[model samples]
Target chain A: MSRALDTVAAWVLGALWIAPLVYALWAAVHPEAYAARFDLAAPLTFENFARAWAQAPFPRYILNTFVLVTAILAAQLVLCTLAAYGFARFAFPGRDTLFMLVLVQLMIVPEVLIVENYATMARLGLVDTILGIGLPYMASAFGIFLLRQTFKSIPKELDDAARIEGCGALGLLARVYVPLARPTLVAYALVSISHHWNNFLWPLIVTNSPEVRPITVGLAIFGAPESGVSWPLVSAATLISVTPLLLAFLIFQRQFVQSFLHAGIK
Target chain B: MRIRDWATGYLLILPAAAVLAAFTHLPIVRTVRDSLFSRGSAIRPARFVGLDNFEALAADPVFWKVLGNNLAFALGTVPASIALALAMALLVDRKLKGQGVLRLAYFLPTMLPMIAAANLWLFFYTPDIGLLDQILGRFGLPGRNWLGDPATVLPCLMTMTVWKEAGFFMIFYLAALQTQPPELKEAARLEGAGRWVYFRRVLFPMLMPTTMFVLINAVLNAFKLVDHLFVLTKGGPNNASNLLLYYIFEHAFAFNDLPAAAALTAVLLALLAGLAVTQFALLDRRVHYR
Candidate 1:
């Protein structure tokens, strides 16, 4: 009896959890008249999506988001790899202190520094640029920490072998340490991509023009009630904005969870 | 050889160090320094005001209001999501049939951007013509405005947060649970311990470290996760649902008051520092126990 009760409760909770997305699907597919009605006989149409697409510069917003995520991920991979390699291998003065300073970013995130960073960006004349949106997040402490842990676990024999082969510091990193840490790299890349893709506050603060505005900011502007909230059209746009990540998560559900787990273990 | 090693190490670290200093470390110092000044405007340039911004913060009712709202939000979300996440982890830890679908259903919302989730919830919260109202009307109930009224807005937003976060938190608990010794469960069962007894005495203690990690994360998110406000309420109806970060965003960007924003950021930094200290203490204790 208890076991059956557990299953029932689990199913109910799951349904409640997924109800919002299902509702978005419902509202998006139906006409504005039928959005709240949910009548089975009601006809479904793609007109709402067409109208939503036409109303907002969603194409441009999507392109900006793509550029932003790619740039952040590319920069993070190179910078974190170099830093993590250094911290994992070298014995240098102030190394521990520097590592601690990097970890400080874990607590006082870029969002908290938005006011001051905005000023810095303005001074550098980087305001309203895609690079400005990606700059603050490129040197990710979590990524460095994760990579350092992975790098540290590799036996010292590998480093010695690579050095005997006339491999320099950068070459050894690119050839040996990085290859061994591919799983960590993939995991960090996945996490970083999703994170900066969804990141809103800093991007919202930095970018003023539509050219640099990501989907999140664009959606915010499009869906605001002041802009005339049409339930069907807004739902359609929301689906369009989120579908890429949602589809990726659905396809790679296990890797997504595992990557988050791998990232969080530190 | 020694100097060469130092040069190689320092060179390898320079790019990451430079960006971190420019963005994270320096901004912290600058934020504190800027908080002591007045926001320069067209009529007058910024001048050092010396604690005036903080004094204004104390006097500002909205500051206190948002602070209370953030605290309430943290209080509401952190425990509820942790408990729910634990329950979910336990649910999926079993060999239940069709559990993959259940896990996916719970986690799907986490994948969607908060802005999109906010838009979807907006449809549900629309007065009179929303999904929620329609459902309520079926039972002859009147619709209460979910996001418009101050009384309901924060709670409503909290509900969305719980939904969005519980699954993400569940993954952590699930990871922790996987690392547990299965023999303990079998031993407890052989000893004829009830499920609640086993969980309370055995499972909960084992999960404490994960709980602490998730708790700190949830607290940080309580302050950070204000994207829903941009769509759901805009801190509307007299700043009823305004969180601290969102309020800082308003002051800095909308109102163009950087000094005031800096002051608010300082308070947020203090709150984060408190949480960081707690995290460190807990981690230290855990390490000692091990």
Candidate 2:
């Protein structure tokens, strides 16, 4: 009896969870006339996707999203590695205070400072630029903190051995630290890519032109109040926008979940 | 070796520090300064007017309303999502047929972007023609205005948020559950304690740390995350759903009131700091047996 009850409850929750995705897939593939229809026999079509594609510059949006995510990840990897190295290995003055300040950024994000940051960007003439969109997120507190924790776990003897090999600081980092931290680096990269891929507000605030707008903002424009959104088309566009990340998750679901758990545990 | 060590360490950290200073630290300091000054216009010079922005905020009723709305949102979202997540985690943790598939299904929503979730829910809530109303019509029950009515807008937003967030939080609980020893649970069952009693007495105590983590994360998410508002409500029905972050966005970007936005931001920062301090203090006091 207890086992039956547990099975029933699990099925209900599972349905609640999977229903939306199934609904989205249905809406995206079905014709507008049949969207609300619950018939299993309803013929699925791809016309909504074609319409959604033509309605917006989705190809351009995907390209821009790719650029934004890669740029941010590249910058974060370089910056976080250095900062994590400093905090993990060095004995510099005010290191703890500096690390704390960086950690504080984890709690207070660029979204909160959008107004002042906008003015700064305007002043610097970076408004509507890809650099402006990606600038604030390039140095992530979460990344720095995560990498620092990972770096501290490595044995100090490794660093000493690298030094005995007459390797310079850069060499030691490139040859020793970076190689040792591959799993952590991959984990951080995955987390960063997923995050920036889904980011909206800062990018929306920074870019005014269609040329630079990422997929999130591009999708928003389609769904804006002024624009009349057909449900099927909107669903199709949403599916398009999320496809890459979704595909990535499907492929690396284990790594993705493990990375998040590892990051959280630290 | 020591010189090389110092150089390597400095080199490793330079790019990240520069980015941090340019983007995060410098902007925060600039925001503090900007909050003390009044904006002349969108493109014009800002003039220094120390604390006037804060004083104006104190007098504005909308500020309080939005703050209250945020509190209401937090209240509605955090506990509901956490409890739902906990329940789902417990359900899936059971040894049953097709449990792996069930776990994957529960976690699928977490992978979808918030913007997409918001857009989907917006469709779901559309009056007369939407799925929800269609379902209600079939049941002979009255459909709600959902996002269109002030009374229901916040709840509508909360529901969407809960759907998106619950699965993500469930992962944490699942991880914690995996680490829990099976002996205690089996021991409790052998004693003839009912499932609810075993859960309340044995399992719940083991999950306290996970609960605290989820609570802090949920509260942070409540304040900081408002992406769905852009598509769903836009703080609509006479600003009934105007959360603090959305209000801050509007003042700075729409109304071009930098100082007021900054002042509002300062308040948000203070509140976040207070929450963090309280979390630490509470954790310090709580004795985790596991």
Candidate 3:
């Protein structure tokens, strides 16, 4: 009896989780007229997909999002790698103080700093540029913290061995630490991609023109306050915006889950 | 293994340090500076006002209301999502058929972009011809104006937040559970302790550290997260759902009040600092126990 109850409860909860995604897929394929109607006989069509594609510059948005995510990730890799190596390997005056200051950035993020950042960008003449959108996020405290933890987990013997082979600081980092921390680097990349891809508020504030707008801001253009939302088109747009990340997740589902687990462990 | 390595490490870290100092640290300093000045317009130069912005914020009713709304949002979301997440972790941890599929399904939402989920929920809450309304019509019950009505707006936001956040939190609990020594649970069961007794006395105690971490993260996220609001509410229906971040955005951008936005941001920074201090205090106590 207890086992039966558990099974029933599990199925109900599973249904709840799966329902919304299924509903979204359904709405995306079905025509606008059949959206509210849940008839099994309603003919599913790709009209919404075609209309949604033509209605917005989705291809441009996709290209822009990819560029933004890749640019930010590349910048973060260089910054976080050096910072983590420094924290993991060195002793300097005010080292702990500096590290703590960096950690504080984790607590107060770019969103909180958006007001000051906007003015600063205006001063630097980087306003509405992709570089501006990615600037504040390039040095991530979380990435530094994660990589620091991963670096600490490595044994000193590896570093000593590399040094014995005439490896300088940069040489050791490139030849030894980078290769050893491959999993962590990949994990950080996944997390960063998903995060910056979905980021809306900062980009919304910084960029005005479509030239620098990411997909999240692109989706907001379709969202109308005056007219009631057309569910089919919105879902289609959503699917278009999210498809790449979702496809990446599906393709690399195991590695994605492992990365999340690894991030949590760190 | 000695101090020479530290010097090399600091050298390696310089570039990142410079970027962080310029971007993160300098902006904070500037934010504090700007908060004390009055800029009549974007074109006008800022004049020092010495706490005048803060004074104006204290007297402003909307500031208090947005703070209250943010507090209520954090209150509504943190404990409920934590509890739901713990329950989910427990459910998926059970030795059941197709548990992997169930786990994947529960976690699927967390992988999707927040904008996607927000757009999905927006459809769910649409008044007419929405799935929710269609379902309610069958039961002969009145459907709600989920985002439009001031009374229901914040709670509606909370529901979507809970859905998005719970699975992510569940992963932490699941990780903690996997590391727990199973002997205690087995021993408790052998002692004829009921399920609740076993969970409360053995499992829950073991999970306290994870709980504290998740609590702090969830609270922090509750304040920082306002993505859904962009698609769903945008501080609508008489500003009922105006969170501090959204409110700050409005003042700076829409209303063009830079000082007021800076003042509000200072308050947010203080709130965040208090949360961090409290979390460290709790974590310190946990360390002592260990």
The order by descending TM-score is 1, 3, 2
Q: For residues B1-290, write the lDDT of model 3, one tens digit per residue.
A: 56777667777778778878877888888888889998766588778999999999999998889999999999999999999899889988879999888887878888777778888888888886667887898999888887899898999899888888888888889888898888988899889999999989888988888888889889998899888887888898888999999999999999888888888888998899899899889989777435
Off by over 4 Å in 3: A227-229, B1-7, B41-44, B288-290
Better of 1 and 3 by DockQ: 1
**Would you give me the overall lDDT of model 3?**
0.86
lDDT for position A170 in model 1: 93
For each candidate in turn, the TM-score is: 0.98, 0.95, 0.96
Worst 10 residues of 1 chain B by lDDT: B281-290
Tens digits of lDDT, candidate 1, B1-290: 88888888899899999999999999999989899988777899889999999999999988999999999999999999999999988888787888999988877788888888888888788888887888999999999898889999988999889998899999999999998999999999999999999999999998888898899899999987788988889898799999999999999888988888899999999999998999998898776334
Chain A TM-score for each candidate, in the given order?
0.99, 0.97, 0.95
In candidate 3, position A176 carries an lDDT of 88
Candidate 3's error at A150, in angstroms? 2.0
What interface root-mean-square deviation (Å) does model 3 yield?
Answer: 1.7
Candidate topping DockQ? 1
Better of 1 and 3 by lDDT: 1
Please state the error at residue A205 of candidate 1 in Å: 1.5
Each predicted complex: what DockQ? 0.84, 0.67, 0.67
